[model samples]
Target: MLPSGAFVLVVIATVILHCNGAPTNCTITLQQYTTIQIGWTQQQVTQFLGSPGIIVLEVGTAGSPYQMISVQYSALQSSSATASFLFMGGSLYTKSQAGIDAGVYTITSQQYTMIQAGWTRDQVTNLCGSPGSAISESGTGNTASVSVMYTVSGTPYASVSFTFTGGQITSMFEVGLSPPVNDKITLLQYQTVQIGWSQQQVTQFLGGPGIIVLEVGTAGSPYQMISVQYSGQQSSAATASFLFMGGSLYTKSQAGMDTGVYTITSQQYKTIQPGWTRDQVTSLCGSPGSAISESGTGNTASVSVMYTVSGTPYAFASFTFTGGQITSMFEVGLK
Candidate 1:
C-alpha cells in the first residue's frame, strides 16, 4: 500500500492532470464525454463525444501538426462556441489554458448557468470566486455609483459583468465584442420590411417594432437582394433603403456605397418611396408590406411592392408609404 504522503501526492497529481479547471462545483450543461478515459482513439472519441459539432481536416505542414477535432456546444436556442483539442504529435491537449482552466469548474444543484451572448456565467460563488474586478462607472441620480465586474478568460472563456444595486448583482452584462454586423441580424431579420398604418393605428395594433429580413427568391432573378449593415458608427442612422429590382432592401455602408455589389441589381433612378407614410400606402397596396429598416426607414413605413401590369417591358409599379398614407407611387416600363 502507498504511504499517506504518497497517496496525497498522487491525488494532487491526478487533480492537476484531469481537472477541467472550471469553477469548482459549477455544473456544465454540455458535457464532453463524462466517461472519457485513456487509450481512446479519434474514432472512439466520435462515439463518445457525439461526432463532434464540427470537423476540420487540413494538410499537415512542417511547423504545424495534423488536423484535429473541434467540438462546440450551445445551449438550446442559443449561440455556439468552439473548444479545440489539438492533436499535436499524436497527443491531445486542450488548445489553450482557458480550456483547461475552465475545465476545473463544477456546479451545484441550487444554481443555474446560462451561456448568453456566447459567454457562460453562473450565478454562484465559484463564478465570481471572490471580489469582482472594477470596470468604469456611469449613470446618475439615485442609481449612480462605481461598478465592479468580474472577467473569466480561458478555455470555455467568459466575462461576468455585475451591475450593482446596493452592492448586489441587480443585473448582469456578459461582455464580449458585439457580433459582426452581418451576424447580428438573422437570415430573416436581414429580409424584413415594415409599413405603418397610422400613428394611432400603429399604437392601437402594433405596439412595438420587431420584424425580420427574409429573402423571397434567388438573386439575379429579378429579386431584390436584401441585407442589413450594423456599424457601431451608424448607431443613430437607422435607415432602410430599397433596391427596386424585386423590392429588396439595400444594405449600404456609412459612405452610402454598396457593400453587396453583385447582389444589388444595377439600375438608374431606382424608384424610391422614401419618407412616406404607412397608412397611406398600405391603403393603396392592400397592406403596407413589411417594414424592414427601423433605425433607418421602411419600418411599418413602406413596402417594396412589385406589380407588373400587362404591357411591353412589363410596366412595373412601386409604392412607398408612411402612417398608412401614400408618400410616393410610380410606375415604369421598358420604353
Candidate 2:
C-alpha cells in the first residue's frame, strides 16, 4: 500500500508539547518554586514566570478526574536545579524534582532494552540488578498494578518507568536516552520479510511466536494482532520492534532509531499549528511526517513525527495532536 495520506500525532510516554515563541528564560528553580502558591491557574503561573511551561507528560483525557499533566521548564544547567510542575484538573497542585535524587541512575539503557512489556516484576529486577522502587499501587491481588521508576545515573535528565498489572508490565517509558548510534535491528527477521506472511510463517523464521498485544473486529477474521520481538545475540542492543496485523507484517522498527523518521521542517513548525488537521499539515509540508511511535488509552491517542534538516546542523521536532488535529509539539536543533 502507498503511504497513508494523513496521520494524527502526539508525544510518547513523556509527551513533549513545545510552544513556538515560548519565553526561554522562564525555567523554575526549586527555591523559587516553593514560593509559588498552589491553586493557581496555568495562565497565572505563566504570567508569573514570563513564559508558558512546556508540557512534558499528560495522562487521562481532558476533564476526566484522573487527568494529570506535568510541565517542565528550562532550568539552571545543574543537576540539582531540575524541576517540573504538576497540574491536576488544570490547576497547579505541586512541583517536583523526580529523577537523580532517588537513585534514578540505578537502571542503564542496556538494562532497559532487555525488559519486555509483559515481563514479570522479578524478571525486571533480575535483569536490572536492583529491585525497582514502587511509587504507586492500585487494585488488589491479581488485579493489582504497580508503577516503578529506575533513574539512569550519570545522565542528569534520564529515567525509565514501568507500570505493571497482574505482575506484568503493561506500559513503559524512558526519558533522555539517545537512540544508540546503531539501533540493534540489523539481524531482524524483518530483513527477510515478505509483505503478507501468516503468523505461523512469521513464528517459524523469527524463532518465537510473537504475542498478540491487541485485538479487535471478529475472532475468526483477518484483523488479528500478532507481535514478535527479536533481539540481537551480541548485546549491541539489536532489537526488532515489529508487529503483524491480519496475518501480515504491518509495522516494523528497531531500537536506537534516529534517522529516516524525520519529515517536518523548521518553516513548517512555525506555520503548521495546533488545531490544524493532519490533512492541513500534510498539505503544507507536501508529505506526512514519518511516524516513530504511537500510543492511546480510552479517549486519548498520540503519534510522533520527527522532522529533521539535511545539512550542517541536524535537528529533530515532535508535535502532538488528537482527533486528527495538531495540539502540541517538541523540537531540538531544527534550522
Candidate 3:
C-alpha cells in the first residue's frame, strides 16, 4: 500500500542491504587507500578502485613526451570525499586525497638525515618512498637532471626537493609551497654543488654563471680547465670562482678582500718547507682553495691542497702532506 517513489526507495535499500549483507560497514579505511604504489598502471588502478568518476589528460612538461593522466574517485564514506591519482607514461606518479586530515605520505627527520650528497636516484627513492611530483630538465645531448618534490597533506606550504644530476642526488632542500622562479638561482641552490661534479652538472643545478673563462689545453692534450665566476646575492662586488679541470670540479675559492692575483712572497715561500704541520701552514697562508686526503699503508696518509696564484701568467700552488706534515710544495703556471 506504499506510494510508487517510497516503494522504489525501499527496494533500493533492500538491494543495498542484500549486497552488503553481514556486518554491513562498507566504508573504506585509510589503510585500504594507501596500498597504491607509484608504478601501478591505469588498468591496475581501475581494477582496484572499480571505476573512477573522472579522468583527465594533459601534456607533460620538458623532458617527457607522454601525456599525464589524472583519475579521480569518490570515497565510499558519506562525507563525499575524493582522491586523485596522477599517472605519467601509463604508470602512477603520485596521489592526493581530499577531506583526509591525516598524511597520505610520511617522511621522517631520520630519513631526511640519511640523504647525502652522493646518493643515487634509486637509493633516494628507496629511502624516502615516492615523491609527489617529478620534474625533468634536459640539457645539451644526453645530459639531464630531475627534481622530485614530496609534499605533505594538510601542510601545503612546505615541500622537500631532491635534485639529481647524472642519476645522482646533487642537492636536497625544503622549499616554500609556491613554485620556484625559472630564471634566478638562489644561494641555497649553489650549496648543492659537490666535489668532482662536471661543469654541465653545476649549470643544471645553479644555472649559468656570471662569467665563464675557458682555458684551452695545449695541442694534443685532453686536459682543459674552466674558471667560472659568480657575483654574490648579498654583495654585488663579492665573487666566487669555481675551477674545473678536465671537465671536473677541481677547486672553489670564495671572494676575499685581497685582489684576484694570488702572490707568495719569497720569505713566505721559504717558510713552506717540509716537516711543517697542516695547522701551521694553514695559519700562515690561510686555508687552501681545495684539499684532498689519501690513505696509505698502515698509519701513513697524505693530503694535497690547491691554492690560486697569479704571476707572469695564472698559476696554482700545490702542497703535498705525509704523516700529517708537509712533504713537498710547488707552484705551476700556464705556459
Candidate 4:
C-alpha cells in the first residue's frame, strides 16, 4: 500500500543520514558546546558547528518585523540526541541540548527582572549567569556570609551587589555613581601641617589666624601655649581653634552655633572628637564665633572656642595644653 516512489525515497534518506562519516557509537559532551554564547551571529554559529541538519524559520507578524530562526543538530550519532539553538534578528538567542551538560546557563533581561530577595545562591546563579566576583566572610558560630558582585556591560558607574547569608540572599542593591566630595580643604594642603610643624609653615598653608594669644608661665618653667582662631566661610557660623606648645602645632577644635542663616545639626556636633587638630574640626563643622586663651603657672594653658547654633550662643569647646601638646579637651552646652 506504499506510494510508488516511497521505497526509493526511504533508501535515499537513509544513505544521506548515515553517510556523514560519524561513528554510530560516538558521543558528545557538554564542554564541547560551551563555545556557543548569546548574541552570536548565524554565520558565526555555522562556522563553529558546520551546517545544521535542520533549519526552521518563523515568520514575523504584521506588527513585528523581526523574524526568529531555529537550527538543530544531531549529537552522539543519534537523531534523537539533538541540540536546538534559537536565533532572533539573525543573532543567537538561546541554546539547549538533550542528555548533555549545558555548563552554566545564561539569562535574559526578563529572567534578571524576576530576581528577588530570599532566593538561594544557586537560584541566582542559574537565573543570572555567573557573577564577576564572589566574596565570603565568616561570622561568629554558624554565621557566615557571601557577597556576589556583577558588572553589567556598557555601564561604567552601575553595578549589582548581592549579599548572601546561610546560602540565601539577605540583601541586594544597585550601586550607581560615587559619593560627592565635600572637603573644603585639599589633602595636600592639609598634610603640610604635620605634627611638629613650625608656626611659619602653618601660616603658609592657611593664612594668618583671625586671633592669636600667647600665655607665659612662671620663670624657669617650660609652661607656654599659643592659641589661634580662624574665621570660617562668610556663610558659615563655625570657627576653628589651633593650639601651639613651644611654638609647634599641638591640638585644634571647631564649633558651630545656630545662625539665623545657618543651623548646626546633631550629626555635625558628634563629629567633634577629643585630640583632633584645629583644622580637622573646622573642616567638619566650618568655623566658630570667638576664640580665647588662658594661662596659669607651671606651664598650664587652655584655648576655648564658642559656637552658636542659631544667631544666639549655644556651646563652648575648650582644649587644654601641657608641655606644648594637647592633654585634654571638653565641650559644654549653654543653659
- Candidate lDDT (C-alpha), each: 0.35, 0.60, 0.56, 0.52
Task: Estimate candidate 2's alpha-carbon lDDT, on a 0 to 1 scale.
Answer: 0.60
How many Å off is the CA of 41 in candidate 3?
Answer: 4.0
Best by lDDT: 2
- Residue-level lDDT of model 2, residues 45-71, one tens digit each, is 777776666776899899876678877
Worst 10 residues of 3 by lDDT: 175-184
What's the C-alpha lDDT at position 21 in model 2? 50
Candidates in descending lDDT order? 2, 3, 4, 1
Question: Stretches of candidate 2 above 4 Å error?
Answer: 1-105, 180-248, 252-335
Off by over 4 Å in 4: 1-3, 6-29, 56-65, 77-79, 102-335
Tens digits of per-residue lDDT for model 3 on 126-198? 8778543553332322245556666644566656666666766655665332222332333444445665777
C-alpha RMSD values across all candidates: 19.9, 17.1, 20.4, 25.4
Instruction: Give the C-alpha lDDT of model 3.
Output: 0.56
Please write out the lDDT profile of model 4 over residues 160-194, one tens digit for every residue. 66666676665555543121122123223342445
| TM-score of every prediction relative to native | 0.25, 0.36, 0.29, 0.26
State the lDDT at 205 in candidate 1. Answer: 31
Compared with the true structure, what per-residue lDDT tens digits does model 1 show for residues 174-247?
43322233322222323433222222232233232211122223334444333322322234234332222233
lDDT of 4: 0.52
